[model samples]
Target: AQSVTQPDARVTVSEGASLQLRCKYSYSGTPYLFWYVQYPRQGLQLLLKYYSGDPVVQGVNGFEAEFSKSNSSFHLRKASVHWSDSAVYFCVLSGPNAYKVIFGKGTHLHVLP
Candidate 1:
């Protein structure tokens, strides 16, 4: 079985400050990890993904995530956030080559200037 848990339902960050989002998951074997961002009344966009290779992977918009096999966690980090970065961040995962992704509840991020 594969499942994801996002502890924080909402997060607020000041502009130009670093941000870190917590995420934990449970999977049987090699898991596919992904992070997505959704803007107001918009669709989700891919932030990053991790498969088999390196544990740390970078994505667009200055986003990155680290995969841990022992902890079964993939946490997202941003060096500096902007006001436009406010939105919902979701940690998603899929079973080994299942092609079906399961989305977490999501965390709403509010960026203040």
Candidate 2:
């Protein structure tokens, strides 16, 4: 079975500061990793995904992550953050079939003014 674990339940960052949201996965076969964000009062949006190819994958709003098979980790990162970035972030994983992804509870992000 495949699953995801987001170690940080919540994260806070000052505007224009760097941010990192930790995530780990457990899977035996092929792993499809993804980072998703939900803005205040909004639905979840895909940040990035990794299946094959480059270890580091980029996403919208200057978000990026690196896939580490050995560590079994895929962590989301951002060079800078904004107030609008204050939202809930989720790390998800899917098998080769890519059905309903298994998601972490979510990490609540708070961007300070």
Candidate 3:
């Protein structure tokens, strides 16, 4: 079984500041990693995903994530954040079974001006 863990339940960052949201996953075999953001009264939007090839993958809205097999982690990073970027981020893990996936509790991001 695969699972995702977001250690931080909430994170706060200033506008235009760099941000890093930590995410750790546990799986025996190869796993698919994904970062999704949920805005107020909206469905989850895909931020980025890591399936294969490059360890670091770029995503929408200047978001990027790095896959570390050794560390069993897939962390999301943004060079500079905006107040509008404030939302809940979820780290997800999926195995070969695409239908089945595990989601983290989610980290609420508060961007300060």
Point to the candidate with the largest lDDT: 3
Per-residue lDDT, model 2, residue 95, is 82
Better of 2 and 3 by lDDT: 3
lDDT, ranked from best to worst: 3, 1, 2
Cα misplacement distance, residue 110 of candidate 3 (Å): 0.3
- In candidate 1, the residue pairs with backbone N, CA or C atoms under 3 Å apart (3 or more residues apart, or in different chains) clash, namely none
Q: Say what the RMSD of model 1 is.
A: 1.3
lDDT, candidate 1, residue 71?
85
Global fold similarity of model 1 (TM-score):
0.94
Model 1, span 67-98: residue lDDT tens:
99888899999999999999999999897466
TM-scores, all candidates, are 0.94, 0.93, 0.96
Error of 3 at 23 (Å): 0.4
**Cα lDDT of all candidates, in order?**
0.92, 0.91, 0.95
Residue 76 miss distance in model 1 (angstroms): 0.3
Candidate 2 lDDT tens digits, 13-93: 899999999999999887888899988778889999998999999999899999999999999999999898999999999
